[model samples]
Target: MELWFTEEHTKDVRFTIRVDEQIESVQSDFQKIDVFQTPEFGKVLVIDGYIMLTEKDEFVYHEMITHVPMSVNPNIKKILVIGAGDGGTVRELTRYNTVERIDMVEIDKMVVDVCVDHIPQTACKLSHEKVNLYFEDGLKFVKTKENEYDLIIVDSTDPVGPGMELFTVDFYENCFKALKEDGILVNQHESPYYAREAAAMQRAHEKIKKVFPVAKVYQAHIPTYGSGHWLFGFASKKYDPINHMDEEAWNKLLIKTKYYNSALHKGAFALPNYVLEMLEQNI
Candidate 1:
């Protein structure tokens, strides 16, 4: 018999993948986590029946989220990652030798453990010397921190379950306060294709725009995510992802990437007219 896993991307749309085996399944304190082996995507990680990352296409999301902001402001040193338990974000950050400290606050320890055991491609750098892992609520963690980190990457799940608060205005306000004057905040801005996801994406963009001096959205093509077109929020106190981006400096580092390149960096911010109109709506 063939094994297949399906997720409801919308009430009418569904995504299915052929699975080789169910490697692990566990009910954590927050949500259900599952790991699967598949031929097309390699190791797949799912949370609450939503696809998070797959080994084959994971580089797109991870590199786009990390390198975009890093390239814009190469002086970034201290970093905080909220809710990225798979360690993919930190894995990319470790490649930057100029980065001094990396603090990852993931509420679900099981996600980290399972990913490290089953998906080492994305989780291999969790134990890096510069990384300090904290198993705590990211919302509360940012509250205690004020003007501490140079960058904060909100690598959260969708705006539901435990991640609901991360999308609120209060949380974005706290994130703004947690960063230095020159700090940057990059978040998992949901896709703009589906209705439900688009609303959340617009709301997040509006909130961040209100709080930060500079707020913009960028797109990436990740086949596993809903609608396959994903957006990431780039907000900063001083830097503009496009105008301030030091393409020459970033190229000088010779950082090899699979999905993100300096040329694409400028192109990603050129949002589609529909997406731009959606973002422009006064919600």
Candidate 2:
């Protein structure tokens, strides 16, 4: 018998990966966490049967989320990250010497523990000096903050279970209030390839647009995610991701990346016509 891990992308579509063995599986207070070893993707982290990250292509999602805002405003020193329990986001942000403090709010502590025990590659930087971990609700965490952080990254899961509130208008409003003047907000916007997912993507964009002065969507290709095409939300009070990008200064940092660069940073925001129409028409 062959061991495999399968995820249902939709009612009719499913993705399966050949698994060598199950390394760990523990039921956390929030959700079920599992780690598996695979030939194609190496070590994989699963939350509630959803693929969170894999050692093989984790760089693409983590790097794009961190570098896109960092390149636009290299002076950003204080960052507030929500729901990034895997520590991949912090790992990339800690690479910047200029980033002084990172306050990460995660609702599930077991998710962090499981990742640290099984996938040390991404979880290594969770203990860095600049990082401060707070295991609480991200929605409530931002509510207590007011114009403090220079950047805020909403590295949340899909709009369900523990992450559903992160997509609401109230949460986005609190996020806007928690950022300093000219601060930036980036989030894991859902994919636009499927009907259900696309509806959620459009809803999130609409809510952010109501709160922030500038709101835009960007794209990235991550194979494990549904449809292999994912989107991210970029909202800011003052700076424009394209016009204000400090490409020269960012390049000077000499930060080596596997999937992100200055060129791709500018091109990611250039969405396809259908996606553009969906955003404009609210379809």
**Lowest lDDT 10-mer window, candidate 1?**
115-124
Model 2, span 1-283: residue lDDT tens = 6999999899899999999999999998888889999999999999899999999999999999999999999999999999999999999999999999999999999999998888999999999999999999999999999999999999998998898999999999999999999899999999999887899999999999999999999999999998999999999999999999999999999999999999999999999999998887754
lDDT of 1 by residue, 177-268 (tens): 99999999999999999999999999999999999999999999999998999999999999999999999999999999999999999999
Off by over 4 Å in 1: none
Q: How high is the CA lDDT of each candidate model?
A: 0.95, 0.95
Enumerate clash totals for all models, in the order shown. 0, 0
Compared to the true structure, candidate 1 yields what TM-score?
Answer: 0.99
For model 1, state the Cα shift of residue 112 in Å.
Answer: 0.5
TM-scores for all predictions: 0.99, 0.99
TM accuracy, model 2? 0.99
